[model samples]
Target chain A: MHEWTIADNLVRLVGEAARKEGLTEVSEVYVKVGVLRQVIPETLKTAFSHLIGEIEFAGAELKIEKIPLAVKCRDCGSKKAGDDLAFTCGRCGGIDLEILAGDELYLDYLEGKGNGE
Target chain B: MKIAIKEDILKEEDRIGAENRREFLARGVAAFNLIGSPGSGKTSLIEAAYRELGGELAIGVIEGDLASDKDTVRLRNLGLPALQINTGRGCHLSPLMIKKALPEIDLAALDILIIENVGNLVCPVSFDLGETAKIGLISVAEGDDKPTKYPLLFREAEVVVLNKIDLVPHSDFDREAFYSGLRAINPAIGVIEISCRTGEGVEEWGSWLRERVSSPAGR
Candidate 1:
């Protein structure tokens, strides 16, 4: 349900980037969503499709890349996959860990045609 | 042409939340963001906390709901300064909304501000509202698997309030599972067990709140 808000923010973000580049029509928008963000790719796409009718984003494609959860072990200094949700160090079975990734929600860039193209 | 513009979509929200944090510090106000599933006893816990700490601390509330001003009315009826933000169809309250509510609150006169986020385990955790701490509420009625199911909230929560412990005897709420689940995400997170109806652990919760609010080194 909140995917719409995410989509709206993404559009505004990409639109700003596009405008600064003098891009009149965006061809694609690439977004990276971390696992911890819990953003459904399909829902985001549907939300984006809903807003593509707007002149600025019309005909633009929404692309999303899912990033897995990763953590940094404080004891062994190892980066471990956080898929287990156990927070344990996969190397030494230590519990001291800091989340290194999987909370991201950002726009990577915009691909489009500039004005007068 | 492709522009190499890598930016966080929620950076604006983060910026606004930071500004709100500064304002809170300038006013000597301690704010907390309360998040959980709907009917997880957030309102009840707030009301209980108000009853416990209202005299010692000048507390205020920012109620976020999809619709209706019921929680706002309830808080205001308790004689505390309260503001309600109806997101309409939105799932969570953004820092911008919190900024809009700040004017309604007398920050200088407030000792604490509690933002009761829209009842959601997902969206509310994604947005920061400039609070000093994020507290997650889970009622025993909601099942013990909530923390496992919604790891993001538990992972980010500085404190987790397990409300309705009074019903633990009546319900199949596994205490071990809940605590272990929370520990799996955040090893050092504080967990408070309370029952608003029976006033079981309101004092503990209130004491934590008081400490957080009055301490010079606010968390």
Candidate 2:
């Protein structure tokens, strides 16, 4: 699954962050995934669990936040947010809509024990 | 202790993609990434374009597949400069791969570079390979509802190529539903129906490529 690729990136990013912040052990990792990405959380979690073992932060917990899809209609200047993938404007029924959000895939933060702790 | 990273996951890939884009722009080469399902005729479409525009336009190809270099051999046999990237377990092609492959091709001598992405619709749609445009391919055998089923590809693709028009008479593929579905996601998306098997509608696709090559601004 492509989730493996995403998980690989997550592990690398979290590992880098842990090293940069002088973190000996990463306990929590927060990630934001948009609906447009179509990443299944359970699969990504499984993938991370399998891959994170190779790194220093083997037991890091991944917390994923799903962002809903939002769009702005150019014709009628209406904005709509939905969980579905329909790209049509709900208000004006226009097909010319600008995507406002829901394409995000990023690491939000990392919580862990510092070198002294 | 919380460290706010706030970094995009694809930041590395995007960085390389931007670099690749700059290189293409500098060389005045129009690069197109072709994405579709396993049997959507992406390679065939490239072949058709080569047959039509190869004499006048200097064309090259970067073929991506899960394991084999079959597509590369096919293109090379036709006297086109071709390179293959076996992604192995990876589902899509990354800009880093393109960056590595670019050195092999003489960009100054080529007008168009067609990249045949690994045959998966979902993963490839998200990865940017620094192409001038992404051409989405869907065949009649895959059903007309594919556009709605995979809206992101339809929305991101510059033009949707409807392959296997030769099978339309035998299959239950509704052209009307396909057009409407594409419109719902991308109102201004261009569509070209072609059957690489029968050589139907390929000239139009060739013409589209020629126009983009001549006028990179139009891409």
Candidate 3:
């Protein structure tokens, strides 16, 4: 499994998002990581830990939201979670399907000390 | 009343990366971050390319690997200016690493600098390397589902090379699925199928590389 390196890169991304949202003191970061990505959560945590000191997400919690792979059948228009890359239409048994979910890896929202809600 | 410098770190990093790229371009050096899965022929392609075009082009390489200088040694054996970065246990190369490694090499002398990123399909795509292009290598032996399954690399790549095509006669890779998936996700991306070993489609790849980097308005 591959983990995003440069340790500081993820920290910077989380820190920037926090600043823009004014959730300067992020208590938690909600990241949506796709299953297809070989991102190891633990390694990301380790990278984040080393990097958080340089930015606003310092001491901030990292919350990972794992997104499973989902596909929408182009043949029959049925939306379903992909099964082992079968990615076939559930209703019509057609093999042509378009991926609808599970390619995402980004910061979504923050639970923070200053979340304006 | 805020005492903290509340910031999204990625944005800050990207800001720095942009500046670095600007400086690099100003110096007339174009960089490319080459990424792919292990055994996808990332290094071999670079060696093949240098042997064919190195004399005409002043090429320099930065090799990223988990713990060995084996790949870097290969590049050096070719007599190309090579820098080996031993990442110990790290999985991918990031902009910061490039920025750190840039000073070691004479960035001003080369027309192109190729960064052979750690061999992985996913992690390497997320990081920016202050490069003009991100070329992803996918071999036929890895199956055609790679583009669809690993969408991030596919989406990030400016050009995708389906390497080792000569072996397709013996493999079960679905070519149609590969093309369709890439087209659906990234219509603007240029696709080239080549056998790095037999030199089957390298002329096209080299031509494509030269074309993109030499385009009048290219950055």
The whole-model lDDT of each prediction reads: 0.86, 0.91, 0.75
DockQ of each: 0.74, 0.76, 0.17
Q: How much lDDT does candidate 3 score?
A: 0.75
TM-score against truth, every candidate: 0.95, 0.96, 0.73
Over the stretch A2-42, how does candidate 1's per-residue lDDT look in tens digits? 68878887777877778778888888888888898888899
Order of quality (lDDT): 2, 1, 3
- Can you write out model 2's per-residue Cα lDDT over B48-152, one digit (the tens) per residue? 999999989999999999998888898999898999999988999989899999999999999999999999989888877889999999999999999888888
Candidate 3 CAPRI classification by DockQ: incorrect
**CAPRI-style grade of the A/B interface in model 1:** medium
Ranking by TM-score: 2, 1, 3
Report per-prediction Cα RMSD to one decimal. 1.6, 1.4, 6.2
List the lowest-lDDT window of 10 residues for candidate 2 chain B.
Answer: B210-219
lDDT of 1 at B36: 90
> Which residues of candidate 2, in runs, are more than 4 Å off?
B217-219
- What proportion of the true contacts does each candidate reproduce? 0.77, 0.77, 0.17
